[model samples]
Target: MKKSSETAAADRRLSTVARHLITTTTNNEEEENGSFMISSSPTAAAGQSVFSNIVGAPEDPILGVTVAYNKDPSPVKLNLGVGAYRTEEGKPLVLNVVRKAENLLVNDRTRVKEYLPIVGLADFNKLSAKLILGEDSHAIRGNLVTTVQCLSGTGSLRVGAEFLARHYYQHTIYIPNPTWGNHTKIFNLAGLTVKTYRYYDPATRGLNFQGLQEDLGSAPSGAIVLLHACAHNPTGVDPTLEQWEQIRRLIRSKSLLPFFDSAYQGFASGSLDKDAQSVRMFVGDGGECFIAQSYAKNLGLYGERVGALSIVCRAADVASRVESQLKLVIRPMYSNPPIHGASIVATILKDRNLYHEWTLELKAMADRIITMRKQLFDALSARGTPGDWSHILKQIGMFTFTGLNTKQVAFMTKEYHIYMTSDGRISMAGLSSRTVPHLADAMHAAVTTVV
Candidate 1:
């Protein structure tokens, strides 16, 4: 009896301690790293959840928009928060060219699911490099670029960040103030310091060019700069070619390293070459830079995760050495990339007929997005929604920063069942002719009623 009483007392003490620990972990975001916490209680350890320390981590601000949208039962609910493209009927798109490429891959009898090298598919790498750098690129001609297929844009960025953290001379990276939210965490966890430079000017709903110049000018020499090759996210504002030239000169003059993220390569103005102008300008100068390209947006290969990382070097020998190091970085992480997506991209890119078909399809998608932007603008204007809505037409790419405050966003969500990130960025790709009026109505109500 005495021993039984002692055991109960000890169990009570442990329960109290466990409660305290759970509270601490919850309050501190302990599971942000996907922490696996063991339970302190014998009962929990023996038969129940061992992960007692787990706090329900917050959903991703960017990705969570979809999560919330999925729960809404409203028939009229529109999810402008999703980043993927949607048809006019509000369905996820699978490009016709992508289907044709997949058919080619599936029918090829010689192809196998063998593991690719750490540098990924050789054909995919060569084609991806050519696609971004152009056919007659100086870097391509001189073999000064080392291209590696990665697990789409995020994977490529992470791999590149890891490589830069390990090999690059400077560890500090300057990203735009309002970049893809993932950028900061990707670099920070890679053991690099991430600082922000002003990019979006909310007051004018456009790029703060003067602020951008000041910020980049102030960065230390050899610091890494993350540039959205085209179709800058969130705000959808891109620098003019002349502005890009100026920015390029400043970056080169300061000897800053350029790392370009080319996610929406063909979406900005419906032409791949036009969208690639920024990255090409930097490469045209025969200087060193890094580029991460994603097929998620352009080729609609979201699930396949097709992308590549290209490191442009001053010389072929430097590029060769960089490839060796990149291989080292990749081998330990994911070992090698999957072969299926790479094959599809390669098949489409290398063939002339399919390539031509892809460009036309890409242009059509871009034209539709451009049309949606105009429709949204006209809808707002037709209602006399009292704001300068011209930015809607001006901001290029899949998104538009609506400049809606959090309260306004919440009001729209609560009353109208419209969903988007709290920061007012909406995926124009998600909007279509059927849903424009509803969105415009929500925007009008939110702007006039909430604020």
Candidate 2:
């Protein structure tokens, strides 16, 4: 009995030891499996260390150029990187008309600071639509046009893009190649694919009419084509009236929807009507279209963030339906646009005397840009800079595409402290009488040195 009891005790001890070994082996296997799982996953590796997998985004090309320009202490530094206009002394400008308009608004003492409708102020919308599409437009007359105030040009474009994405099934938007850089981002963010059509030809230093037409012709029917109403951005090249007509016909034939971005209107040609010719033509042809208008450039109200988006439809009922959908798109993006800028624009447009004065001021600004273009052209020509400088004068509005290669542009910046886009687009408004000669000298040196 004593021996049997001892054996049982031994058996129990052995069983206890086996159980311990099994647990130890299972824990070791678990540790190995966990390490293998972590090693297998890139995400798990990233989780293992905070700084291990971070990648920085590239700097914005234009903003980076501006930052470099700002850091320079050179007295003769010229910033033509941005499109904002500057005076003869190279200072930012605020129009006198804007001041008067502000005074008028203050004098009226309009109350009600409550949230505006998603469509924005009624008077602002009415005047904005009239300004873009003639007051006598059939769409307006038939009550087939709907306008909604938005957060300046970019915001307006985003809202319009969203509206198109939600209501219209045309999933692709065709923009000009070398378009304002933000256009692609805006449309794509709104769930639409952005494709490009040929626009500027660097070799000719001008518009590629044949390429543009071919691209338009080849685009799928019912696709959306974005057109710069006037003074094409970046390139400063515009299609002639004849070319615009042809484009209009092709768009109509292909059943492609037209979206006009009229940011520069009055600032383009100093005549609002002339700048709006393209949009008016499209509207007059009884084609459904969209117009995004900004008061930033024309009214010198950049900070005010005032703009409108208008949709032209086949009938008043359709216009209402389209506007309702636009409201839905805008509600989530921004509850409502600010009131100060819209009130200022409405005040100016309502008073005939103020309106006339504002027109003169706009014309003056436009004329100054035109004169700068001429001066730059003459300066380049006098210096005998290689290549055609005529495009300087030929191009209208605030920018002049100098056709300078990237190397020449870097040379200009490094040697002369002249800041411009790598694409060689120089804002003529930034060139004052005092700096024109200096810019000309730099261009001359760069060109000759390259030769």
Candidate 3:
């Protein structure tokens, strides 16, 4: 009886402590004003939290860099995260041609805010196909090419994936090993099996041509392969024209379908024709292929989200049926694309003077990115930072894979106010002459101090 009484007293003491702790927590929570600590509506009287069971999703690594960079209050903070082009002053840029086109649209009172057709503007589709697949493309002249306006590169890719998923003979898709992150997600979500072919070689920081050939040769006939039309993202490594011809021959011989994601057309070589040689090579051969063209990077119409998907088939009869099915894929999702962005692109592309001016501005942007790469390379060299920095100069387009690991990336973010993806990918467009030294110092410290 005495032992039972002692246990009862201990239970009472524990209950008293638990109650005190609850009261203290409640009072502290009520006193806190910061959003980090307390909810905006802290009281239960407002409404019950219906999303209580929903788990917190992890932050997007790419976009999360921008978010973190924006939140940092440091004056020296640098954002080498997003691939969006920026002026030398580190400001987002809209091309003069884009502005001129917008003005033309604004002044033309005949233009209305009416919704576009399910297939999109006829002229925009025709012009976009011509832009990617030369003006004299026999497939287009023969009515064997089906073009549809979709969202920018990502949207175009998604729409194309959906169409392929529904109609293509095979379900397996071979993407590059170090491809744009969205490639895997987009294709997989479309209900297709995603596979990877060797592309980026870490040791050389270049293309693994032999491995790529072996992988493609081994893939089953009719398997779909995603090709970076130009200016491969993240890694910035692309196969040479000679290598591309060999790849095309192999793919054609194997009867594998090629889906070209042409995000950076004029942004790579600064010459549209030079950048499009690979796609044109495949098209010139009389086989089937898919192309997704984006105006975001080249034309600076990112917010406008203008792009198109072109399917080159064997004959006009097949293309007609394919286009009809593409309508079914788009009708349920978005129904039709936004008209303004497509209108802007169509205007500039159609006008000779504007097209020339657009190419000049596009070249300027590409040249600036190349200059930044050189500046960064020179800066790193001057500091005598360990490792071969030559890849900075060799890698093409807006991004450079810096070879920095995850821990080093975190160190740079914490010690210096520099931001980039954990995979060590930095947007060359985001770098400037002014910020090169800061990045150099941070990188030097990141590499030397850590290991």
- Compute each candidate's TM-score over C-alphas: 0.91, 0.88, 0.89
| TM-score of structure candidate 3 | 0.89
* lDDT of each residue in 1-451, candidate 3, tens digit only: 4444324433543443343334323332221211012123333544657544433434466788899999999999999998899998999999999999999999999999999998898889999999999989998899999999999999999999878776766878999988886787677656667788999999999999999999999999999999999999889999999999999999999999999999999999899988999999999999999999999999989988999999999999999999998998899899999999999999998999999999999999999999999999999999999999999999999899999998899999999999998889999999899999999999999999886
Candidate order by TM-score, decreasing, is: 1, 3, 2
For model 1, give the 10-residue run with minimal summed lDDT.
27-36
> In terms of TM-score, which candidate is stronger, 2 or 3?
3
Q: Name the runs in model 2 displaced over 4 angstroms.
A: 1-54
Runs with alpha carbons beyond 4 Å of true place in candidate 1: 1-48
Give the least accurate 10-residue stretch of model 2, judged by summed lDDT.
Answer: 32-41
lDDT score, candidate 1, position 171: 75
Provide the lDDT at 416 for model 2. Answer: 97
Backbone clashes under 3 angstroms, per model: 0, 0, 0
Winner by TM-score: 1
lDDT of 1 by residue, 1-451 (tens): 4444324434543543454355445422332222223434444566666665444566777788889999999999989897899988889988888899899888989888888999999999999999999999999999999999999999999989888876766878999978887787677656667788999998898889999999999999999999999999878999999999999999999999999999999999999988998999999998899999999999989999999999999999999999998998889789999998899899999999999999999998899999999999999999999989999999999999999998999998999899998889899999889999999999999899887
